[model samples]
Target: MDRRNFLRTMGTAAAVAAVSSTELGAVTLGKDKKKKAPAAETGLRVRFLGTGAADWKGPDDRGEYRRLSSVLLDNRILIDFTPTDADMLPEGCKPECIFYTHSHADHYNPEALLNLGVPTAYLGKTWISKAWKGFADASAKTGVPVPEIVPLAIGETVVCGDIAITALPANHAIDATEQALIYLIEKGPTRILYATDTGGIMGVAARIAGIDPHVKKGTPITGLIMEATMGMGDKGDEDYRLFTHSSVNTVHRTVKMLLRRERLLLKDGESVYLTHLARTLHPTQAELDANLPAPLKAAYDGLEVVF
Candidate 1:
């Protein structure tokens, strides 16, 4: 089948196979939740809808699982709409906006949004044009309304409600011609640096994180949701993958750089959670927790962090 036909088939499957609420783990807030806040008053909450790299494999017993790389913020802002994300929209949650990190199929699924009806979507200029065309084509074929595609310029901050978001440069792509983005999201006093699908946090991202206009100096970020797709693998083991995804060593080095530059100032209990894990490079979640240092943990699907 051609690529277009394959995507159409996938979209049909995704629309029919929407996951049940049971598949989504129990919703729990962070340690700070003394009494559950009213639904209308719920503050910043982030949930990892998927936490695996593109090539991640399920265990033998499961046969096949569809956990891809995506994060849902406050159940209303979605970053990346992988197939897994499309299959599992949180119960009673309708995201107002969707943010695309790049044009990678894993990060941006045009079919997933066919029926979602999300009002606004933020993506790079190139991606915006591509998405508009793709959705228009799909809509003509399937009769679904094409969503509004807005351009997200790198280094420019866009505000959605109370949240202020800036798209920073990401060093990742299928090749030199492709473009990628890493987001820095700020809500109220809490700031989160969501950097994934990138080899390392350098260039414009490093500079922006080091001195963000929205965040005050010496104030630590509420959370740093980063990717560790290569685990602890050496460059010699896999040369091609290392150029786009980060390893455990890269995570550590980036963290150190942020600290050395006073870019990340964590409070007594704040932490960094790693996502987009590769099964081949890491062991079970239990083993990972037992071995990883304090404040750095491997995140799993349904994991929630409230700030």
Candidate 2:
């Protein structure tokens, strides 16, 4: 799509009205909300609808399995959508928006997105044109009108309801021209870092999470849902997959550094969950829990948590 057509489609008054309906009128959440507030008063609900690497394919003999990686926040915003996620959504659930991490098949499925009937889908500005073409072709085949595609650059923030979502550059690479992303989500006093399809925390994300000491610190992270695609079994720093996916040691070291810098906010003994696990490398959840260190738990397909 060209610039004029893209702008005309995305900036129309009807599109704006559809997007505006997502804004919560009565919900008021501020950064200064009392730390001691009740859970129902200051918490964001997150459901892990799918949590697996690219290699996962349905169920296995051990009765262990996972679908493609995806997350639903407050049951309104989706981090990613996949074809397999249709069966995972709650009954009568209707999401309003979707924020993509990249264009990888595991993270972005045009059919699943169009099927959701969401009003808006946010993507990185560098690849929105390509994304528009893909969505247009899918819509032609499926008879579903394409949702508005909102292009966002790194560091850009968009407000949906009382939530503020900021995009951060990811350390992963797909091709020469595409840029992957992680997100920093905030609601009231709760802040969450959703990092997936990325190797490690990039410099910009590290600075924003207050984990980089040389730069000005930003806010502390309340919860983290990160990917560990390159499992911990026998992978080392020299592994080629480490460049695009995180391993066990990588997550552990990063979390330790963040803790030392006081960049993570945990309440009532909450732990960070690891998603996008590889079926071949990582063991069952029982074995994983026995092996992983404190505050790093394995995420399952139906796991839900509040932060």
Compared with the true structure, what per-residue lDDT tens digits does model 2 show for residues 1-307?
8744554444354345445554333322112212222223447889999999888887877788899999998777899899887788878777767899999999998878988887679889888988999999999988999987888788777665567778889988888888898998878788889999889899887776555666655578888888888777556355678779898778888888777777876776798889999887788888988989878999998888988
lDDT of each: 0.69, 0.79
TM-score per candidate, chains pooled = 0.78, 0.87
Ten contiguous residues minimizing lDDT sum, candidate 1 = 24-33
lDDT of 1 by residue, 57-109 (tens): 55434342437788888676799876566656677776666888888877777
**Cα TM-score of candidate 2:** 0.87
Cα deviation at 50, candidate 2, in Å, is 0.5
* Deviation in Å, model 1, residue 27 alpha carbon: 24
lDDT for model 2, please: 0.79
lDDT of 1: 0.69
